[model samples]
Target: MGSDGTTAEVRCVAAVPCWVSLMAHDLDVAKAFYGPLLGWEFEPGPDRFGPYVHAVTGGEAVAGLGAASGGWGMPVAWTSYFGTESADAAADAVRERGATLAVGPLSFDAGRVAFAADPAGAVFGIWEGPLGRARRLDLLGAPVWIELRTPDPFAAALFYGEVFRWDGRDPERFEVRWEHDRVVLRAEGHSVAALAREQAGGPAGLPPHWEVSFAVEDTDAALIRAEELGGTALGPAFDSPYGRVARLQDREGGRFAVISAKP
Candidate 1:
């Protein structure tokens, strides 16, 4: 059991995004930036992945923060984690589907973990362990959505569908459908994520990546707070079909988004 009395053992539904993590150049700095902006507190997490902590809000783990030291030399970015029953098997599927397996299906105190990049070079992680009660997709300050910005949304969907067994999964709980120009993945009748074609060859163009969006009470207020905390608003808050959204970059150049909570 965890210190909070929650069971440390949880079998998360395989192939669903169970957690999200950010590797920052400095752990304290990341905490300081997010603490005030999102009303997040911190708690100790597994150190097997380096100095790591769980970002807690309302006594629930919303995200993870890790210090990007020890010659890791990776970019300071947020990587989304999908839950799996077998980390090694997922890693194998990643390789078989022509994706690059970057890290290990190594064992940690709570569970096994691995990292991989899709064919489009978008990096993501896999965890075979306790999800705790951190998988909140609607609560304020928790990750609400994850979007895949890639060259071809259809092809990307195909790749992920095979890797995660999205097609063969129980349809009542997990479903995928094409909505307009994007491919949407819904868990339990609610939209959890989407894949859309990325912008190309422009100043605003972003590389193929998975963008994580957090829930906020006020989009404009969050952007203002982000600037005051040394983060940049990559773009102004704009209303999407989902909600008012703003893209942001941390002081160290990690990109993420914030969306205002629905009434």
Candidate 2:
């Protein structure tokens, strides 16, 4: 049991994004930037990994912050973890499907985790453990959705389908509509995540990556606080069918979003 009486049961179905973690080039800057914006409180992670910090909101572990070491060469970004019954099996499936395994199906005090990149070069994770279900979208600071920005949405959908068994729209039916061209993934009839085609005339030099959005009470207020805390508002808040949304880049250049969904 956790300090909040939350059990570490795996509630999410297989292939659904269950957790979101940030790899920070500077942990201290990350704490300062996110703490005020999301009202997240930090706690030391499992004893084995000393530098890992778990982002807690309402006593629930919502996300994580870990130091990015040398040789990682990757930008500071949020990586989404999909739930799996067996990390080892998932890792094997990723390899067999032509995706590259970046890290381990190794175990820790909390659970088993492995990192991988799809054939299209978008990185993601697989997790199997007691705390795999620790995050809930209903929570104030929890991730409401994750979006994969890639140049090849069809290829990404097919790659993830083979690796994670995701049920997405048929490739033959794909169409780029609206401002954002994306395909939604569903598990057990519930929308889990999305695969988006890279937008034209957007920021240059941005690589294919997963973007995590947190649920907030007010998108406008969150964007204000983000700038005050050394982060930058990538764009003004805009209303959508789902909610008021805004994109933001942290002090360390990690990009994310905040949304206030319509009830």
Number of colliding residue pairs in model 2: 0
Using lDDT as the measure, which candidate wins?
A: 1
Model 2, runs deviating above 4 Å: 1-13, 47-50, 69-73, 131-136, 167-181, 187-190, 199-205
Every candidate's CA RMSD = 2.5, 4.8
Candidate 1, after superposition: displacement of residue 126 in Å? 1.2
lDDT of each: 0.81, 0.75
Encode model 2's per-residue lDDT on 1-263: one tens digit a residue: 64433343323345667788888887888998898899888877753443677887876777888885555667788889987778898899999988899999878766788999888677888988653322455678878778788888888777777676544533332222323356776443334468888853346346787878898998999999999899999878988655788989999888898988777
On residues 101-156, what C-alpha lDDT tens digit does candidate 1 reach at each position? 99998887768889999988889998998533325566788888888888888988
Q: What TM-score would every model get versus the actual structure?
A: 0.92, 0.82
> Using alpha carbons, what is the TM-score of model 2?
0.82
